[model samples]
Target: MTARTRIAAVAVALSLGVGVSACSTTTADDGPLVVVTTNILGDVVERVVGDQARVVTLMPPGADPHSFEISPKEAALILDADVVVSNGLGLEEGLERHVDAARADGVPVVAAGELVEPLEYTAGDAAGTLDPHFWTDPQRMVDVVDGLEREFAVAIDGIDADELAQTSAAYRSELLELDAEMTSAFAAVPAERRALVTNHHVFGYLADRFDFRVIGAVIPSGTTLAAPSASDLDDLTTAIEEAGVATIFADSSQPDRLVQVLADEADIDVDVVALFTESLSAPGEGAETYLEMMRSNQRLISTGLSP
Candidate 1:
């Protein structure tokens, strides 16, 4: 090759290399650093942030929000995050300390559930105590998305405000559609048959939204961290019998054997319907996203409750 041709080719290669480097640097710097406590909230953050941020979820897929514990490395990740998102309101019992530590380290810890209008459980002796499972209702999750957007804007400066606003608006519309679909889907069940029996008391918001009654739970508390006594199980079984609840909705993340034992002892022919409650399913599972999880649950509940 001529010397001129070699020089020209070298210049072209250098130009291409510089362009690729510039693009890579821009992408790395433009994406905001985000961290979520659970996979469920991670999915929601993904929907909101899209490609504008780098999101790290502390909990693995299908990990129980109430009982899943994180390691020191994960805890360090939380502490160093730009914004740490969590369901809050005690839903993440195992990671609450790490979240608090994150806050102590000056990381912004956003509690998505605190943005929602919380509902209280009125079953048995525990009346008027707030239920932490707000994501059960899609409308409440809309508020959570709003809170997350605000947090993202504050944490991710230099981002296009208009773009973020537009993204949030679009996500809000999707959430509204989900809310309407769930309302219509749940309405098909007969009113009396709308009673929900579950392994834990995690459906207060869902029951409130769809006019279903949460008859009883095997755990008898909003959180699975709380153990149920034999007497508590007896009382719940009695309530289930009295209410004639045909289905006990068990969390897919939790063991269903306890509920099976209860069902066998009751001998009431009640079916145990497994639903995604606290955490979402693994990718490719039907209930991987929050919207899909809610719809799947709506279908299961409505189908199980229908006459």
Candidate 2:
């Protein structure tokens, strides 16, 4: 081979190598690329992974997981991730397609809902359906951490298993502290006043966890995509009156129009309060992380339900 020709070939090979390395940036990091579906789960995974992996969260802050769609770039992220963590069981209606596509692409998916013991709505339009909003209960969240830690140890290359287990234990301790705080704080609310009328059936786990009664949701369904009929609102209004609920909680991410309308329609005066029920709030707001979100919601719920 001529010296000039050999030099040209070497240059071309070097250029191609740089391009390949740049293209695999996500995978070229220190550890595996983990794509999380929701901000809440993202926070949890971030805490568990620490600096071990590159955790890319798909859902933005204050966006509803049920209706938020991903961009093409975010979808590509899922396709290229080493593993995907999602709150499956139909919570993420809009992101479901991307998750399915990622799964079909042979990416490992660790679903939180499937890992924990799922609860079902007893009444309302979504009766007998599995409830996907389980993070309201810290116990279930600990289960999520356990599941995620296991997945990370197995799927994420270069992940330190002992470190992951230690981090999981530490985060689980924090979750337990959150549970204790919630239980102590909620003790102020008498059992009779523990009735909850929220934006939707998003607190079945919370109610079941702390022995609060889920009076009913304004939308009468699990997801925010569903709207309530006049009859549904009327029934909820009656339930509120009978339950003597002082405050009706609405999601901070959603419009409070329905809760206000129900409050106005009820024969008995009721206060409509907003809570960070569905999505995490932006930084500086009370609920930026999963733990903060739970604490903030606990305070709001305690105040709303207290006599």
Candidate 3:
């Protein structure tokens, strides 16, 4: 199948809320296939690869990467893919077996987390473990793009080197511009109020990059699958009170009930704001791409924290 036909099929499947495998049926005449685990990585891979390959992103838009499961057909796509891209560092809990199977079958797998300098959770159950949400920092994402370009040139057969170089360079420039924008936007906020409390521990990289303090998280764990105890909530409330945080940011892909409960039950006054932290939103929902997601979060964080 041609690139146009494959893109049309994927668009139709997404419109109908179907699995990625529905549009990723391969043929002898088709280009190379790239099976990506998360939509965030998928967006970057698509931007890097352009139309030279068929990219099948397993995780749907606005879905939690920690617990989203895939169909058998999607698993088959991984095994049959020329290259498989994942966030790695244990982010995709539901697709580990499939990714391992593809690796065992001799397919090249490029992990974004491994490409960037990973950060560890500072105060949660995953404190000593590697954090997989490196996309939170656009500089780290540029590193991943550099790695992807190198990996794709080797892994994807018949890929045009000149086209890949051009696309990757263009996307890298955009990421650098995004990093500068975020830095500028965040610089306006007072340093004393640059504390962040989220629904989970998803912003360690962002905090490290932008000189913000991660006060605490509602869940107190790195993954959304973990729950926060009453003690966790109490401690976070105390920390919030001490820091005098005016806004608590929650993941747009996950429910903000825990955040809301903390805001309502706590004696301190705090506003619960949503940010596109982990997953991208659906079309026209403000965070359709990685760049859009970062810019939206930058604006929200600046406005939400400014006194």
Candidate 4:
């Protein structure tokens, strides 16, 4: 072979080698990725993981978890994730397939719901079904954090165990403080007025934890996607009147139209108060973090119900 031909071939090989090297460098620098389905769990995972992994949160702020869909790019990220975090027990109705695909590919999934003691809905369409909105109870959130700490240690390869432990412990401390704060704040509401009426059955855990009663919901279901029948509204109105519930809480992400309509239809006066029940709000809004969300809701519930 001629020297010129050999030189040309060598140049082509060098170019291919450089391209492959660039790809490898990008992958290494990108590090491990953790894909979280819901924004609520996203905040928790980010706090626990700190700077150890890149967290790609699919659900945006103030978005409904039950019906939020992901783009193709976001779905692709799930399949590539080293570990995926989700609020399981049928909470994320939209991203189940992507989560399933990631699990099928042998990626680790940390379902926060599965970690805590689950409660079933007592009266809604989801009655007898496991509740996924466990974050309403800070004690349950502490349980989730505990599970996440253990899972992150094993699932995230090459993570600094000491750093992970320190971060998890710090966050867990915050959760316990939150629990204490909630307990104290909720004590002010009069026992007779300790009934909760919401747009949906999203506060069962809160009701259980704080010694409040779960009156019927406008939608009469655990999911926001469920619409209320006229009879459902009638039943909830009767519940509100009988329980002497002066205020009904509605999810900020959802329209308060139904809540208002219900209030109008009620024989007794009912005030509709908005709360960050399911999703977090944008930065500078009331709820930007998990702790902030819970704290904001705690204050809202206490003030909205207390005499």
Q: Kindly indicate the candidate among 2 and 3 with the higher lDDT.
A: 3
The lDDT of each candidate is 0.76, 0.80, 0.83, 0.81
TM-score, candidate 2, is 0.89
Candidate 4 local lDDT, residue 12:
23
- Runs in model 2 deviating more than 4 A are 1-30
State which candidate has the highest lDDT. Answer: 3
For model 1, how big is the CA root-mean-square deviation? 17.7
Count of clashes in candidate 1 = 0
Evaluate residue 68 in candidate 4 and report its C-alpha lDDT on the 0 to 100 scale.
76
User: Can you write out model 2's per-residue Cα lDDT over 1-307, one digit (the tens) per residue?
Assistant: 5432333333222112000000112222556788888888888888898878888887777877777776677789899989998999898887788899999989999998988999988987789989999999999998999888888888888889998898899999999999999999998888889988987788899999999988998777897777666567667878888888899898887777657666766757689888887778888998988888999888888887776
- Which 10 consecutive positions of candidate 1 have the poorest summed lDDT? 17-26
Ranking by lDDT: 3, 4, 2, 1
Query: Please, what is the TM-score per model?
Result: 0.87, 0.89, 0.90, 0.90
Error of 1 at 106 (Å): 1.1
Query: Tens digits of per-residue lDDT for model 3 on 1-307?
Result: 6432333333222112112222222122468989899888888999999889888888877877887888877788889999999998999887888999999999999988889888888797788888888899999999999999999999999999999999999999999999999998899999999999998898899999999999998777888777666566678878988999999998877766557667765567789999888778888999989999999999998999999
Steric overlap count per candidate: 0, 0, 0, 0
Which 10-residue span in candidate 4 carries the lowest summed lDDT?
17-26
Question: Using alpha carbons, what is the TM-score of model 4?
Answer: 0.90
Question: How would the candidate models be sorted by TM-score, starting from the highest?
Answer: 3, 4, 2, 1
